[model samples]
Target: MDMLDFGSPRQTYDIRVEYSLLYECALGIGAFTWDEVHDKLDIGQAQVLQIKRQMSEALRREVSLAGLHHTWRSVLFLIHRCPYLPSTTQEKHLPVFMDWLKEIKDSIRTEAAPYLGASYQAPLAAALAGNALDMQKLLDEHHENPVIYQNLQYLFAVSAEQLLDHIKRLVEGWYEEVVSRDRNVVATLEQSAAQTSALSQNVSHEKLIHTVTRGGEFVAEPGVTTLWLIPQVSYRPFTIRNHLPGYAVYYYPVDPDAQTGLDKNRLISNIAAKHKAVGDVLRVRLLELLAASSRSLAELAQAIGASKPSTHHHLLLLRTAGLVHVDGGVYGLNVDEVLALGEELCRLLKLDGVKAAQETSQGR
Candidate 1:
């Protein structure tokens, strides 16, 4: 007889919805750093420029002095490293985060020393660890990688203490001047998180992640046991993925419905955008290839006989329309969204009246 054996229990994870005004404060500042040609930021260029101009001279001076526009990603690292407690306000967390940064300033410099002047791909983990990388080399080597190389260059030039001080002042000033003025932003973030939390209760983890990220997939690695889903409006139209020790984090775009509350015009605009995305012959061809199988930019370009830039532009439109999703650099069609187009149109036009009438007639 075989020995009696008990198998190991399967590892599982819990998804938690969290929101903080601090995140919005940092991301709002980061938004100014986005490049028009590459980043698909939902905020119009004119709006972003106008917002920047509206900032107080002191706040604007700190932003420029700290080179926050170049090293803006550093603020994200600071936020993630800071311990968070649910329901804590930005006021409560800001001082604590700054103190923590002060305590670890030396260690940050130590960790960063090895990478300075060395050629390496700038990984988010490394950046979070305070590494000062060689941006020029990174650009030369990985031309296609979408990173603000100036971030690394700025890190290399500044001392860790200086960097931390600059970031602290910038964040505090931002919260006071920008975030505090708009109480509605905090309410919006909280409402979005609550709505997403409700949806998560009824959906499976995979389905919830896919829906929230607009079709992006998540594959857990070993020892990961929790997912932190944060709904944000500052980084609208972009779902940012990040990681920390034993936890995977997603700062996803808030749903339009949560923001606008059943506005028919917004619905119509969304439908029109989707139709426009599919209108181009080249885009249709790109979708045809993606429908058959997932592909990379180079692969899709070759398949459609288009240049990389042209192919990327078409794919961007499809992605903005929710018909395409890219995960880990591989592009795939969002079949569910594609299939729902007809139903969406019908609902928008109130054609559901016919179905309701037929159902009423056939009812017992």
Candidate 2:
């Protein structure tokens, strides 16, 4: 695959930051160690074929390049481990766990050990118990191995690089099938490609990439360092690389100031401004403590390293901004609003009971 380097730092940071949002959502909701949510994820043999058909059929209809890019990445993501797709609606359109349930056990072992507790395993087992073949087919078709983590009642595994390749092929097969069946979809896609590409030498110094390709195509690549590529040369980057069937190359950086055409600072400034209301060091610490769980006003103040009266004053402000709310003598973040933010907050903040208890004692 031709590695075109788009030399821009601010742009790259922008892309990574937005991508982080998706990852955050996946980590938060998808990783919920609860039992009820885990029980419904059953990918029977027929369902697996359906997933293949939906994607294959979509391709036959001239899949939107943007949709295809995200879909391909989603396939890669599922293969890695089923990720929890966050949604605000009451009902989920797709099973959050899917075939990825088996990988959850390893993720727990590796990434979430301390905070996850043992509550997650039972639900996880419930989710994966019936789907015996989805992940196996995913791994085998992709030519990768699921790392042998300890066996829970369920088998969880993922293949990193190869899975990505698998997604690429699926996209290609769909497109080929579509071109044979429907001429319009392919023609419309060609005319509306996301970016125009030509051999351009002018690029920023930082936005450089090295890779190999056949007549300009991104081959199956295993990221940058872990595996080395030969015949490496530099070029410009494009989404759904030129003439390379199914190879969608996302630029590492998105323009921070311009997403389609908007200022990043403008988008985030108001949020930063709200920090002032609950943004004070003491207020933040105290609010964070309450957010972790319900606590007495006195408890929060101690956690904030302040006297009860001072902390109480700050909590009042947080409540005003709709960041926190008080019930009787206890304080807490509005759980409804917090949950509405999707599962991303699980990492953005941690719930700490010790801080609250300490603060409570201090207030006493």
The numbered model that scores best in lDDT is 1
**Segments of candidate 1 deviating more than 4 angstroms:** 1-11, 37-40, 64-70, 84-87, 108-149, 261-364
What is candidate 2's lDDT per residue for 87-190, written digit by digit as tens?
Answer: 22112312333223334433332221111123433444433443456434433533432121122111233333333333344434443332222222222222
Candidate 1: clashing pairs of residues: none
Residue 198, candidate 2: Cα error in Å is 12
C-alpha lDDT of residue 95 in model 1: 71
Q: Model 2, residue 320: what's the lDDT?
A: 44
lDDT of 1: 0.70
Each candidate's clash count: 0, 21
TM-score of each: 0.56, 0.24
Off by over 4 Å in 2: 1-76, 79-154, 157-217, 220-251, 257-264, 267-272, 275-297, 301-364
How would you encode candidate 1's per-residue C-alpha lDDT over 19-85 as one tens digit per residue?
Answer: 8777877677767655452246665664355455445566787777544434445676566666543
The CA lDDT of each predicted structure is: 0.70, 0.35
